[model samples]
Target: MPGKSGEIIDYIKNDLERDPQDIKTIVVTHHHFDHTGILDKLKKITGAKVAIHSADADYISGEKTQHGSLFMIPIVMFMKIIYRSRPVKADILLEDGDQIGDYRVIHTPGHTSGSICLYNPINKVLFVGDNLMYSNDKIEGPRVVHEPENYKKSIEKLRNLDMGVILTGHEQPITSGANNRLDTFLTELYD
Candidate 1:
């Protein structure tokens, strides 16, 4: 939700010409440093309630620490030096099937223990944060290796959803045939 350098707050206040305080809530997909780089600052400015899955709430709040894979150790250390995660206390603890405004929270844990996807049933749009990525004209799973079993199951759950547009945390969105793109990604995953 928060871009690096906490510029998103400025964009919301200046470019969007809106009061950050009017924001009802801030939804966090996970507690990864990249996703949460500016979260604490944003919350302070917006005075918005923070919502995150229970599994990751502690880590984000600085009550617990996160451990990455052996391969990610260096990357995590670098993030610590560069980004310096700020602790955030979640006002609302989310779970699968929970509704936040018009979006339904779908627990898609793989990239992180509390990773989630927000599906808007009315518009049929899904915001998948790092659970799936758009790459090379194809839909793909998380780039980093985490919980493969959970990742596969998460993708399968998405396969059952009636999605129109697929928005991801990074890269371009899949505007058309989201299910088809997901299907292709699934096939690749299973193979």
Candidate 2:
């Protein structure tokens, strides 16, 4: 959903049919340029508090550079050049298990140390970042991983949640029997 600053503002008002003023918080799942590109301007426009996981907060704040991944360099460079991506300070530095609105932050690292998924217990809906992507009507692991062990552990932990719907970073939402599909994937993963 992240795009150029003005594009996001326009999408919020036009496509989503919602006023920008109604946005209370800008929750970034990670510090990838594509995701955080609009954070600064969107926050200013909507006056929304920006939140990011503590592990990745420095990346967005310009306190630390994003390390690891050769594939990211070109994309990052492009975003910087075209979208004018820049660091934006985070108002809330989230930790694992932190609650934001109805969602609980689940720190799912590997793709990035600060990668997280927001889970709404009542709705059984999970918003997974690049750690897990929806593609071809199924869930697939991220294209790049920074920590393999941590990534496996993160996938293992997701099995504990009673999930019914999965809204990943890409593709359409998996709205039915997500738990079974995920468990199947986990079985294949461990086996």
Each prediction's TM-score versus the true structure = 0.89, 0.91
lDDT of 2 by residue, 1-191 (tens): 24667777788999999999899998999987767777777888999999999999999898987775687677677667676656798999999999999999999888889999999999899998787877776777887788788988998878888898888776688888788888877777777
- Collision pairs in model 1: none
Q: What is candidate 1's lDDT per residue for 1-191, written digit by digit as tens?
A: 33454467677879999988889799988887777767887788888899999988998887876667787667765666666556888999999999999999999888888889999989999999888888888887677746776888887888988999988988898998888888888898888
Model 1: runs farther than 4 Å from truth? 1-6, 74-84
Where is model 2 poorest over a 10-residue stretch in terms of lDDT? 1-10
Say which candidate scores most in TM-score. Answer: 2
lDDT of 2: 0.84
When superposed on Cα atoms, how far off is each prediction in RMSD? 2.1, 1.9
